[model samples]
Target chain A: MTMKIVFQKTSGLTDKPTHYCPGCTHGVIHRLVAEVLEEMGVLEDTVGVASVGCSVLSYEYFNCDMTQAAHGRAPAVATGVKRVLPDRMVFTYQGDGDLASIGISEVIHAAARGENITVIFVNNAIYGMTGGQMAPTSLIGQKTATTPYGRDVSVHGSPIKVCEMISVLDGAAYIERVSTHDVPHIQKAKKAIRRAFETQKRGGGFSMVEILSTCPTNWGLDPAESLEWVRDNMVPVYPLGVYKNKATGNL
Target chain B: MGKVLMKGNEVIAESAVHAGCKYFFGYPITPQSELVAYMARRLPEVGGLFLQAESEVAAINMVYGAASAGVRVMTSSSSPGFSLKQEGISYLAGAQLPAVIVNIARGGPGLGNIQPAQSDYFQVTKGGGHGDYHTPVLAPASLQEIVDLTKDAFDIADRYRTPVILLGDGMLGQMMEPVEFTEGTEIRKFAKPWATTGTLGDGPPRTITSLELDAESLEKRNWDLQQKFAVMKANEIRYETYLTEDADYIMVAFGTVARITMNAVNKAREAGVKVGLIRPISLWPFPEKPFLETRDRVKGYISVEMSAGQMVEDVRLVVEGHAQVDFFGRTGGIVPTQDEIFEKIMMAAGGVTV
Candidate 1:
């Protein structure tokens, strides 16, 4: 009997194992991006900026020329690289702590300038790398190390809705918010990533996909429970949809 | 190019362009704003780029980016802006990227006055950023030297794979003088095999990072940087001495203060005072050879500056207490006059306190 292979690893990822904890969805998100790059056939011609956080060592995992950026400065570093090499594809993989807390200014300015680059924003709603501190995207009443009494809007500011905030920028060509809770959502997330890269290939300015990810260890949940939490909790706050599409001018 | 009249900051931009610096990222600050404006108008003409970043921090980081891409990139600012750039500077040094940073000295601890001052002496020479690293600081006293050293800075940066700091003052930035640039000279190029331009699919991917989590690895990196710095010190020490051969007193200064003391030494010579001048061009390698040569014969050395005796510390350190070393400075944006410096020289030699 002859058997056909149904699944294979992507060439866009290196052989190195990731340092992310078990039950974490970062591995899934990385695979999605790597698969998209491999599918697009631009993995050889793309440069990636790995942001500071758990993904800081992502340069070791991505099968492209990579730069490890200082906390929150990946956008600025990508801007420099893309400006110098306009034909090469450039993107930044950033976490919520890196993007929303420290790097908010860099992303805002990159969008304002309409810099031709892609941004992969992973929102786990907590700082996973530094032992589960509260994050800028942490949901209301969420309990973390810093917010032991649960997040209070009276004390801490509201969780930043990055897609909503970034979609309003004139320079942003494509903006979407996706989730990684289940198979269907994960497929949709891959499609969004492909579109963002496609936008960049066609000289679209400032494409971003804010992926609602799961942090099982940090969130005090099992791998299965984390997916349920994202679907039940995060999806309500960060709705899954394309917030902006410059090509269609549709929300 | 033949001699043409130009402002100090414009000279810096044009000289950098001549040196093959096709990319400039900077934020607008007083004194150094002319350099940014000049690059804005000039870089595009040469098919280069000039990006005005949101802040000096972002500007330096942009330079860091371009530097990682193996291009001759530059960013400039005044005192407070330079302070903001310290974080990126440390990153650039830690990553061992080649770039040039210009600090047009101004009065500061805060938003001090916009007038020219040498208050950043300690900040520049003592390694302004946090790291076990040093940047080769180049001090150009005249517009002509600005043309020469600006190009040298780019070359030195690329040669060592390190950031180079070019020190100037508000006087150097705003003043006008005639300068001749060596146009059409072939810019020197260094191959950067380590730059991250994307993988070629034939090799493993390259990662450009400064983070070394392992203690031994980080310590080794520090040692490698120190070894590189030793080579720089040995090969890059640059300074000028005038009449130190048979002088009774040697006066030390740099940048604009050097020019003033030069004139002061000349007038004192006409009055038959045995005075000389020594100006350090490469401030970090802090030219100790001149002091070593004249220390036994000279009665004392006076360090003059636009600030409160910062470089004098180095002068004293180099002299090794062999002779009396004194400091004369005018802080808070005051440019010391030639006559005042000449009188100080005369006072050290004799009692002529004019």
Candidate 2:
């Protein structure tokens, strides 16, 4: 019997190792994004904007040209890049703290303007880079560093549903929320990533994929348990589904 | 081409187009909204981009992105809006990106007013953001001067791989003057090998970032920036002198105040008082040579300004006890008349209270 290769790394990813914490789902999301770009034949003509969270160093892992934006400014930067080079595909990779807390205006305005770009939003419900603080996406009862005794909805407010908020904008061509917990869900997340980039390639307008990710270290759970935690706690609030798909009229 | 009467703000916008600026991102603000409007109408015609950004902060970061992609980009705002752009300006400096920023200044400590004032001299020249960096600031005294400087700003920014500011007051932005765009303008092209444009099989991908986790590396980056500023200070000092050959008193001013002080100098000369004017064209490099050269010949200097007392500190530092330096100005959107500045010059000359 002849041995054959079952899998290989995509050319869209650099050879360098990632700095993500062990058992964090960020690596899986990164691989999925790289695979999507590579499969779409846009890896060479793509520009990536990296945000200011744990993924701040994402520029090193993405094979395409990358520009690192200041905290909460990636969408504005992506708008700039896309406007300057409309033929080139542009996307922003941001965490919940970057996209939901501080960068809300930039993202909203970029979508409102119908900027033809893509966004990969990783919602892990915690600020991972600066320690495990309560992110804007943190669940109402979730315990974080800042919320040592579980988040109080009355005090801290409910988790932001970014997909729902962005979907209401007329300019948003596609919006979806997917998870990266299980193999089946991982496949679905990759499909959403592909659709987001396809929308940009076809000049469909602003497309975003909010991935429900896992932060085992920050969640104080082991790698396997974190996935279960995401399924049990995050899925109910986030609700995995496509919020808006302009091509399919699935709003 | 004959001269055409143009508003200062519009001329700045047209000049950026003539200088090959392909992207413009800005928000609306007083005294400078005409600039944004002009770009909106003109950029699209020339196959360029003009985006009315969500805010000044977003506009500046957008400029950062376009500039990193190896294109000439610009943004304009008034005082308060300019204050919001400082963080992005610092990041541009840290990333060594070339960009042009225009500030049509208004009165300010907070939302002071939307009238011409030069209160932002220190905030601009001293690096308004949190970093060990400096932006080369150019102060234009008239509509034509602003047009010329706005064109040259792109070149200066690219040559130094740093941000260049065209600092004008509200009068400069709001007033109309005869400007001939075809004369004395040189079009030069620059190569941007460091831009973050996709490699496209030409080379490895480029990464434009300001973040450095290691302390030693960050310090080294800061030192490199300081060295670039030192070179700029050495080679880019610009100013104008009027009748300073045989004077006992000199008047120092810039921007719109410089033009007013020039009239004041002529009036003082008619009264048999030997007074001259030193108008600094570049505020950061600050034309210190003029003050150093005239220190011994002049008995005293009167610093005229639209602010309380901003540029006077720089004049005092350059004079360094060689002569007495007195400050005279108005504040809160108030502009001193030519007669008011003349009286201050006479007061400084005679050592009498005015």
What is the lDDT for A58 in model 1?
91
Query: Tens digits of per-residue lDDT for model 1 on A121-194?
Result: 99999999899999999999999999999999999989999999999999999999999999999999999999
lDDT of 2 by residue, A1-251 (tens): 99899989998899999999999999999999999999988888999999999999999999999999999999999988888888998999999999999999999999999899999999999999999999999998889999999999889998999999999999999999999989999999999999999999999999999999989988999999999999999999999999999999997
DockQ of 1: 0.76
Per-residue lDDT for A166 in model 1? 94
Q: After superposition, how far is residue B324 of candidate 1 from its true place, in Å?
A: 1.7
User: What lDDT score goes with residue A38 in model 1?
Assistant: 98
Q: Which stretches of model 2 miss by more than 4 angstroms?
A: A1-3, B183-186, B352-354
**Whole-model Cα lDDT of every candidate shown, in order:** 0.93, 0.92
The alpha-carbon deviation from the true structure for residue A242 of candidate 1, after best TM-score superposition, in angstroms, is 0.4
Instruction: Report residue B278 deviation for candidate 2 (angstroms).
Output: 0.9
Candidate 1 residues B101-127, lDDT tens each? 999989977999899999999998888
Task: For residues B1-354, write the lDDT of model 2, one tens digit per residue.
Answer: 789999999999998998989799999999899999999999999899999999999999999999988899999999999999999999999999999999999998899999899999998999999988889999999887876788778988999999999999999999999988775566787888888777776788889999988999999998988899889999988899999889898889999998999998998888889999999999997889988899987899889988989999999999999998999989899999999888887777775434
Clashes of 1: 0
